[model samples]
Target: MKKTMKDQKMVLIILLSNIFIAFLGIGLVIPVMPSFMNLMHLTGQTMGYLVAVFAMAQLIMSPFTGRWVDRYGRKKMIIIGLFLFAVSELIFGLGTNVSVLYIARVLGGISAAFIMPGVTAYIADVTSDEERPQAMGYMSAAISTGFIIGPGIGGFLAEYGIRMPFLFAAAIAFVACVSSIFVLKEPLTKTQLAEIAANAKQANFISDFKRSLQPLYFIAFIIVFVLAFGLSAYETVFSLFSDHKFGFTPKDIAVIITISSIFGVIVQIFLFGKMVDRLGEKKLIQICLIAGAILAAVSTMISGFWTVLTVTCFIFLAFDLLRPALTTFLSRAAGIEQGFVAGMNSTYTSLGNIVGPALGGILFDVNINFPYLFSAVIIVIGLGITIFWKEKQLG
Candidate 1:
């Protein structure tokens, strides 16, 4: 069935809105998390472990959530995920203990595992190959916009109290949740539904997972892992680096994140998908990875607020473009099992999250700039993987 323009527009709005709210909650916490932990009297490895815990939870649950979306429906998974996110946010408000906060993050991670893959699969279901890259870009831009707003708002509110940000984040999520329930529609076609039904009944999780490890998928996985890893590492160390190098306050760093987020939105919304459609995601991925790596390496050479901020904005643009194209390519590659396939993509990302922040934290204790340099090395390796990886004829 040919989709109407209205259907496409509605789905686009719904998907973008969902992503916007989710990231709003996340970005709000990013600037304040280390300080929040300090309030609980935690530091060092404990904080690193907390970061790992969030990623680890997502890694553990993503595959199951993906499969569940395949068997059930994307809409169902989305609503459930958002509901869980609401609960997680409430948990944050209910406690001041580090242990309780850790549990909230774990819950948040699980919610994320479900929400992200489900939304990707839903967009895949609605959009044609020709339209998909652009749609993905728009969704990514919505996320970047949230990143821009959330940090600034969170930082401002944090002066009153950290818990206030949590309350505000949750309130925003609740509003989005209500909008999702009424506004989002399931867009899967009959053939797509049948395809999922057939695959869902007989596919062995372990066997199918092993078989899904084609060179293209493997390359895509590596690309996503490196991208996520590098970004997470940067985020984990940003506050620390800003403080040490430029004596930046939390509010100042929040402003940096907000500005970088604006660059990220421009790149994702205006540049990325169209660039990929014109140049191909494969070439764009290669270019962005190389450029990002170079920029990251250069970031280590800079000191003080202005230089760091300049490089950070460039890095954000590089990152914003790379991720959407990577995800769009991976979703297209999944063929009939889009949810499960997309889930694996999320799993690899979570794996990167688990590794990047932990390693960055450990390296930070050793030297402040090592993490950035290390991220450059990882990106180069991913670019090399993309070179030899064969492209599969998806769909």
Candidate 2:
């Protein structure tokens, strides 16, 4: 029994490590995006397209990836996803043309489609219903840690060359892929696999997704979408906005993001699970939405570096808290259809990712503050939807 427990702990560590590396790869290039735009002589609109294209690919692939996770098993999908991430990063690092950058984004999106659902399903397979929230909190902390560390490293490395961070990210992802191949184990039993197969035969991806759209589930999906959209609007234009407003460089932008992400990591690690248990998902979501909307709006008005940092820290804290809460709600509501629901979650998030950057880019060209203002409005609308929603309608 002790040996079994020890093995499970090791497996959990491996899963967390893989997730951390995947997210790190995503965050590592963020500080250098504006430099890429300058090198390509791209406009804000083109930059938006660059950001949105990745999410668009994820949006198209997530449903299929979710189904594949159940059919093929999580371990295989995870390894493949990490391998793709490495290849995509390497391509991005080496490429000079904008077309090649597009190809890299598409590959990265596809890799995310596979990895996100696979990781979520694997966690569900290993954890009991009651323990799932805490597990998810840990997962969120891993992602937060990656975001916290990646930007600092990327910014520092960019001194060597803008491409250096991309290469570093590729190396890290390759290491993760190799580790997953040797260390990761499938959590699903034969019985679970047989049941999953039977269910898969009866329902296609579209059908499974449609069936999961209960009112509570729909609300959960909407929350995920709004959160992603609001955050992405800020993220997609943040460096550019900072540069225009304060003449901040890549290193300055990296420091701001890293500091905000540090607060996010702390919230996810030390407070998220406890808050969810005490407040419940519904109440927590409402509180976060309101707080996030206010902070996001206020963030646009800040003038100094310290002021911006303080506001963004609160904004990130609220966002980080909302993520685990909403995910926990959806996971509890999903029951046995873990992979399908998780895929749908990614799909909605990808849709938001697509729209947010596109709109933000256009608004940024209009005025630097427009994106944040728009995000605040959108978040307020999301809050209103949650307020009117009835819990009993889920049944």
Q: Highest lDDT, which number? A: 2
Backbone clash pairs for candidate 1 read none
Question: Please, what are the lDDT tens digits per residue for candidate 1 over residues 1-395?
Answer: 64743666876787778888888888787657767777878876777677678788988888888887787778888888888888888897677787887898899899988898899898887787887888788878887787778777788888888778888888877787788889887666657667787867453556545655766577788788898899999887988988887889978887788788787887776767679767888888888898899998998888777777888998888898888888888878876677887788888899888888889988999998898899899888988888786654433
Q: Give the runs in model 1 whose Cα sits over 4 Å from its true position.
A: 4-7, 31-46, 96-99, 159-161, 189-194, 201-209, 249-252, 391-395
What TM-score would each prediction reach against the true structure? 0.90, 0.89
Per-residue lDDT tens digits for candidate 2, residues 1-43, read: 1133234787778888888988888878877988978987878
Error of 1 at 291 (Å): 0.3
After superposition, the stretches of candidate 2 with alpha carbons farther than 4 Å from their true spots are 1-7, 33-47, 96-98, 158-162, 201-209, 240-252, 300-302, 388-395
